[model samples]
Target chain A: MIKENIAFKNLFVTVGTTKFSKLIDTITKKEVLDILQSLGITFVQLQTGKDFPGPKLDPNVEQLCSIRSESGSYTVELEKKITLKYNEYFEDFNNEIEKSDLVISHAGAGTCLEVLHKKKPLLVVINEDLMDNHQMELAEELENQGYLYHCTCNTLVQALKQDFSALKHYSKPEKFVFSRFLDKCIGLSDGK
Target chain B: MLRLLQGLNFKNYTPRYYFIASSDTTSLSKIKELEQSVEKHKQGEYHICKIPRSRVVNQSYITSIFTTLYAILYSIPLVFKIVPDLILCNGPGTCIPVCGLGFLLKTLFIKDVKIVFVESFCRTRTLSLSGKILLYLADVFVVQWMCLKDRIQRADYIGQLM
Candidate 1:
């Protein structure tokens, strides 16, 4: 049971640099909608990369797709439950991530790492339809390590409803390892 | 890598980042993210070069030729102006040309730039096309997975960079 006044409100959805229509489509399902509403999520910022065709909203749901002056900023109101922002490139994307309580994204390494860096509650939905099925390995590894939660088209709603306390136990990636690697590269370059 | 570079103390060496912008829309957002992250740190200088997207698999001959030509042409100015002590690149089709340029500079132009190639984390089983090409040119090649290390003689397994 989701508390009506829980701190988790803002939900940011991103599909990395490729199109994942299936993910967008799955999230708009009626079951997922009910779960989100139960959890009191009001706003959803969807960074649908150039390829995702808009979600298929139910006929009864009132949706207003508006074009604002901003290049990739648009709003879609779904059944008076969630306000969806179909935004392109904006400075606010990271700001939105910082502000978000939970981030739902396709399993792109950059997006996943950014979300983890912010230490937000992340739910990754793997898009198997990708050209190489590239994201599956990383998503599975992270999920197995209890760093982040992952789901497929069939299991997203269940994964969403569960408590994500494991997020707190997940350690932030160490910066020193990469710095050492860079130091080594620099050393090699300078011949020292 | 950008974040790591940004956070460095830089007591001895000044690092410059050079990126080849991808034509894809998602790449645009990534570039924006990188720019913002770097700006937030307020450290280091970087350059972005735009080149034609190179498709390795199932691409027409003409397209491949055009991509190769454009990449080489775009890299010409970069070769001369942005000669760094080391060139660090990850496995991607775009990096092939850049690494090739670095190799050319090292052998012909007598530039002392060392190339470090990090295989993409996505490759758990097989070497990517970019990784395969870079194996011969790169001075130091690192792989995230042990499997890749076993397969490639020169690659060193340095655990994953998460």
Candidate 2:
């Protein structure tokens, strides 16, 4: 148990904002921001595209830590000067992914699993209202495999308040493997 | 030598078939419940039962579409067995229109059936007209392949059926 003894800092949280899905509304964004604030984590959110506007962290969260809600949206908050750029590049994005010690992601299980394969700790927040309940299953599987933390918005917020370090330490030792699926997809099989 | 060849033939030719059962919106809850039932059975529980749902396909009054949907849905289960231990479904959109009746009947009459659904369509990519219709009624709609590791939802791909 990595107790919060030392000054716990340098934490990053990423939220997905791809206008591909309209699920990331004001309430969901605020919920994610609130959790990061409670955990005393430094955070950065990723906007998948340049469709909808990006939002600033809750005022309270902004005051407590160095939080930047990065997005490709055109909107801005007057209080914080976080810049909005129109570049859709992965160079900077991938770099940011590598830098973060912990990542909070949406329940697009494939994307999250790809991130998890990077060997960083992940706390996958699933949107409960998905028509298919796909996100819920993804997060739960990662959680079961001992590699990620899974929760709804409210439960995640409570968890952050308790201790972020404990959650980070809870990551399991098992490696996530995707070879079998790849084998099938690419048409390679031992002819038995 | 003959006995060895027979043993080898059996080992090499054992067929591995994966059935991807499609379910619709209405069947989602029952499928989830059955998943839990399977888990309990695995944990040494006795007489695990599936949650049952009735078949009802909505129809536009234009013609006999509902009747056709009912006939197709009902006949599937009769042709198929509920005994497969690994049943994968794909929907969240439209598998139910054609398969929900089968799922319902199996749950009502069968014992020890474990069915899972894989949501396999990404709506962002425009599908063919028929594909669009099926996607909407799928029991599980899947986007990424690896995301299938999730349980109760049966998102994991247990390999494509032979």
- Top model number, lDDT: 1
* DockQ, cand. 1: 0.34
lDDT of 2 at A155: 70
lDDT of 1: 0.71
Which candidate leads the pack in DockQ? 1
Backbone collision count in every prediction? 0, 27
lDDT assessment of candidate 2: 0.41
- What lDDT score goes with residue A134 in model 2? 41
Over 4 Å off in model 1, which ranges?
A: A1-7, A39-43, A49-55, A59-90, A161-163, A168-170, A185-192, B9-19, B22-62, B73-84, B105-112, B124-126, B145-153, B157-162
TM-score, candidate number 1: 0.72
Q: In CAPRI terms, where does candidate 1 land?
A: acceptable
Give the alpha carbon lDDT tens digit for every residue of B1-162 in model 1. 454444344443445555555555655556567566653455455456666556565567678878877877877787677776777778666777778888888888678778988888767657777788888999988887776688888888765465
